[model samples]
Target: MREAFDHMYISCWEWSISVLEEVGATKPLYPPTMLRFTKRDTNSATPGPYSYPAMTLDECQLADFSEFETFDNYCYAMFTFYQLIQQTSGLSGEVNLEVRSPRFLETVASKDDIFLIEGMHCVKFKNDRFEEKVMAHWRREMPVRTFRRKDRA
Candidate 1:
């Protein structure tokens, strides 16, 4: 990280609270927090993208966000993740894309969002598996076995 910063310019400016204050940004945009996990959404009537991506953090982390320059920026960061869940969703009748590891999270948000944004080492998006009964229902013409979520245990 330092190498890249040093390479860009002769004078390597350090990012600090004072610098942020000078620019009217008192704190980091997104504080370190945990990515809220999702459970099965049973409501069929609801929209297609059932889950909303949220960040969960302990009291310490929440306090960190208090240093944010603007609440709008903070909230925007949250909504952006939810947007990604929608964008990366699988094809029709398919499952949502998985956030398997730290690397994949970078696609939607910045690297800082991975560590500071989600405060998690690994973020994964799980696909639902289709059950045998579901397949049998479509006896005339069944889609691929991986078309749906796995059976609920």
Candidate 2:
């Protein structure tokens, strides 16, 4: 029920007037900048203990999480880490809906190269070399036009 509530979007949130008393009793606490969490538990070994701050793309890049070429895969890796945390603590009572590399960079499909997946086959290729090959193949068939200013022409 807690997880379901976290995932759901509600138009209304119930707040009690106890906020007035709490605020009067304590120092002013600033509002949180982010709500989503990608927590890690050091005790778990499946997801390990290392992580890049995943709240933003800049944070991920700064943390050198370059192994993930796409955002979806990066998040999948984070989720896996937290899952291991729950599993180790015996807190996982919900069904897991994802299957991915244990660590953020352990993608079973491709790591540092481009891959083409067809049916059950995974074909890996050199991305830069492939681009060059395609360009060379079509270079002669296609013509390039140089644009010049009217005055120069």
Candidate 3:
């Protein structure tokens, strides 16, 4: 359980970095960016321990969270973090960098708002021209792969 939470945070952090870069941000709107892995037990009174030291933007780089490269995956990761926080103690139940950064605000109408879904809290953002631009940027930035066909012998 602790391992899963750690994975979720790390995944979200990496995703945040990618989104920020895509939006052309020099740094997270918030400082002392919380980029690290933490694990918490199920116990309500216990505090989670940080596995890695907090990293600065220059020192932090994306990890292989490719499986969560899609927006759906990103939302799911956030939802998972929300759930984990509600289930544990000494864990922060707050909005993450990806959802609150000013860079994202340029592309969306709002980001700091939260809504309840099926009794769980989640972040919401309105789509705008920025979404289209981001898609275009991704299309240009991502590498295309091809496979060679073998000739019949």
Cα-based lDDT for every prediction: 0.29, 0.29, 0.34
Question: Roughly what TM-score does model 2 have, to 2 decimal places?
Answer: 0.18
Q: Which ranges of candidate 2 are over 4 A from the true structure? A: 1-64, 67-69, 92-153
**Candidate 2 lDDT tens digits, 28-106:** 2212332234344436422311222213323323553333333333333323333343443344322222332223233
Comparing 1 with 3 on TM-score, the higher-scoring candidate is 3
Ranking of all candidate structures by their lDDT, best first: 3, 1, 2
Candidate of highest lDDT: 3
Model 3 per-residue lDDT tens digits across residues 31-149: 13342433333463322222333343334344332433554433433444344444542344433434344333332224323322121222332224323433344345434211111
Better of 1 and 2 by TM-score: 1
Q: Estimate each model's TM-score.
A: 0.20, 0.18, 0.23
Ranking by TM-score: 3, 1, 2
- Say which prediction, candidate 2 or candidate 3, comes out ahead on lDDT: 3
Deviation in Å, model 1, residue 46 alpha carbon? 36
* Clashing residue pairs found in predicted model 1: 33-118, 99-124, 99-125, 128-149, 128-150, 129-149, 129-150, 130-149
